[model samples]
Target: MRVTITLLAAIFFTAVSYAQVAHNNLFTVGIGAGLIGGLYDGNYPYSSLKQHGNFGLGAPDKLDGELVVFQGRIYQTQHSGKTFPVDDRQLTPFAMVNFFKADKKIAINSALNKEGLLHLLDSVLTNVNGMYAIHISGKFNYIKTRAFPPVKAHDHTPLAAMLPLQHFFEFNNVQGDLIGYRLPSFMDNTNISGYHFHFLAAQKDAGGHIIDVKAENITIEIDVLDSYTVHVPPSRDFEQFDFKKNRAEDIKSVERGDKKQ
Candidate 1:
């Protein structure tokens, strides 16, 4: 009887450990389906992002500006090519956030171009199937980014329709933080399957969705988010939108670059 009790205790402890690790997975505020479905409403407030974790990236309600949270600070960039500090009173329709704890840290030794930098990150990944919240900060030789402006209330304009109105920014030989997420390929149906990154200059005055980057002597920190959580807004447009139709092409175009309508 003593031996049986010991075995049971060991098993119970092991199961609890596993559950705690799994609970560390990523927490999402809303589904990307809302974006693909054209449900742009400011339902989730900026305070919600604060609750999920300290480091993450997201857009404001009505796609007003680009948002990046680092070290518990929220940064916003408007379409006027201006960046500023953000407040919790702001609302968000969609955002991804996590309590950032580094699972691994790697020092990039050589100067890597955009493609090479991406390859380096992929090679060091501890789990190909795990969701990762990534941060890269250091001297960047050059970086290109763009921010989306806010739309009027009840406009109901699809994101694709707002592409032409996006404002682009370019920085050379600057230091900043690259806030990003790496989702599994299986998530392509609801989110951008690969890497999605946002940028904020060290000065906290300029940054946006990362387009291209070049740098060296960088430090990359990655946090393995093993759990997934999503909150849906109670907006009517989101409720009535038909996500059954395929919008992968539209999503890809807006996320990357637009070639066709």
Candidate 2:
């Protein structure tokens, strides 16, 4: 009877240990997915309207802005502010961005398949827009608008070095024409209408040396003026949506083997 009881206890403990390992693995995978999707959603930039040259007609400086452009399409125009407005006339952009050495392991040993992972990413992307206001908080300064530091081959090891402050633009499920849309105009005009996203990477090398800690923030405000005429509309406020307490915490509880209350 004593031996039988010991064997049963051992089985129970083994099962618990296995469960804990699985939980940790799932947590890691979820965190990775969150980071990737968040970064991807944050990088889009707004095109600034610029006066290339005066049209033959006595029109003021010909102000023009481009809509979404692909990865390498450059929009180099002189603008006063860090944020620019994207014209609705421009085409919706599509591009795939890859972060080097973000993931330490190549093979993801999680239950999430490619389709499942993409779905999870879509959910994350959907929640990000217009949901939270971004405030710059970190070491890197965007005041200078400095270019990203170059990457070296030696910086390939796990956490060898974090990528330099980086930013990119990504647009998904974009709708509406680029030219017909109009933006809000204000008398004071302090508050900018658009989305600005930021990301900071923290990495630790194999030697436990902290390297390549950086932050990248991009602001892409959609320009309403280039697209449509203004019509004064009644004010309607937004409802507060909380995903952290609802979705993130629920996933955490499941991984921790705690029953949902």
Q: Among these predicted structures, which one has the highest lDDT?
A: 1
Q: Give lDDT tens digits, candidate 1, residues 1-261.
A: 999999999999999986565447566676786664566677877776787777888777777667888887788887776888787887877777777888888888678888898898889775778798899989899998988777777666777777888888899989988999988877765666678899999888889998788977789998887777777778777777787877677777777757465
User: Candidate 1 — worst ten consecutive residues by lDDT sum?
Assistant: 18-27
lDDT (CA) per prediction:
0.79, 0.21
Clashing pairs in 1: 25-225, 25-226, 25-227, 64-150
Q: Give the TM-score comparing model 1 with the true structure, all chains together.
A: 0.88
Model 2, C-alpha of 154: deviation from truth (Å) = 7.6
lDDT of model 1, residue 82: 82
Quality of model 2 by C-alpha lDDT: 0.21
Which stretches of candidate 2 lie above 4 Å from their native place? 1-72, 75-142, 157-261
How many steric clashes between backbone atoms does each model show? 4, 12
TM-scores for every predicted model: 0.88, 0.16
Q: Name the runs in model 1 displaced over 4 angstroms.
A: 1-23
